[model samples]
Target: MAIEDNPSREALEFEGQTTVIHDYAAKLVPGILQTEAYAREVLGSGARPKSDEERDRLLSTRLARAGILGDFHSPVMWSLLDEAVLRRPIGGPAVMCHQLRHIAALGEQRRVRLHVLPFEVGAHSLLDGIVSLMWFEDLPPIAYVEGLRTGRAPFCS
Candidate 1:
C-alpha cells in the first residue's frame, strides 16, 4: 500500500513548477530565501516545536527548494519585505546579519529583486499576511497566502 500525504511536498512541487516567483512578506522572510541557520532556528523553536528528526526533514526540504534558485532555468524571484522583518532580528544579531548578507548576495547576483516596504509606508493591502504569487507561462497563476501558522493556495481561473 502507498500513503501519500504531505502538504510541504505539494508546496515544493508548486514552487518548483513556477517560472516567476513574486512574494510579499509582512513579518518573517520567505522560506525560499531563508538561510540554513535561520531556517533551523525557526523550525526548532515556536509554540509547538517539532522533534529534531522532524525539523531535520523539514530543513532538508526547505533547502532543496532553495536549491532550485540556482538551477539553469530558475525562476526570477521578486520579494518585497516589510521593514519590521529586518528590524525584528530572528536567531540573534549574528544570525540575522548572516541572513541579511545572504539576501544582499542574492540581490547582487540578480537572482532576486528585493524591495523593502518601509514602516513609514503605513498599512497596505498585504499587511495582514504573506502573499506569494507564482506565474507560469502556460498555466494560470497561483497565489498562496500564509499567516502565522496557516496558509492557503488559491487558484484563480
Candidate 2:
C-alpha cells in the first residue's frame, strides 16, 4: 500500500471490489499484511507528523482495507517481498517480531501466498517500489504503482 498524506482513494475503492490481489513490495510491508502496531508506526512516521487523532484515523482506514481478507471464500492475496522488507525492522524489535509472525501465520493458514526474493538474487526491476495488480469479477483488472513520491492506481480495462 502507498503511505502518504492521504492514502490513494482509488486503490482503496479498488481493493474492496477486487477478487484477487497480486502485491509486490521492495521496501515496506504492504498494507493488507501489516499488523496494527506496524501500521501505526508507519502512519506516524510522516515527515509532517500527524496528531494522535489524525494518526488514529488514518490507521483505522488503512486497516479497514484488509477486511476483505477475512472471508475464506475469495480475494486471494499473493504477496511478493524483497528480502529487505523482512530484514528492516520498522517498529523496533517487538513490533517487528509480531509483524513477522503475523505474516508467517498467514502463510501457514493459506490466506496469502508469501514469496521472498533473497538479497543474494541482487539487482532487478521493481527494486525501488511496490506494485499491486487486482482482478475483479464484474470489472476489468488494474494496477497500482507506487514510487518514492507518487502513487497512481488508475483502473484500466
Candidate maximizing lDDT: 2
- lDDT tens readout by residue for model 2, 1-157: 3355546445667888888999999998887788999988887785676899987877787688766677787588999999999999999999999999999988998989999999999899989788999998988889888643346776475
lDDT per residue for candidate 1 within 45-116, as digits (tens), equals 768868788788777876887888887588999999999988888999999999999999999988999999
Query: Cα miss at 52, model 1 (Å)?
Result: 0.8
Supply candidate 1's per-residue lDDT for 152.
65
Clash count, one per candidate: 0, 0
- Give me the displacement of residue 136 in model 1, in angstroms: 0.8
Q: TM-scores for all candidates?
A: 0.89, 0.89
TM-score of 1: 0.89
Lowest lDDT sum, 10 consecutive residues, model 1, at 1-10
Best model per TM-score: 1
Give the alpha-carbon lDDT of every model.
0.80, 0.82
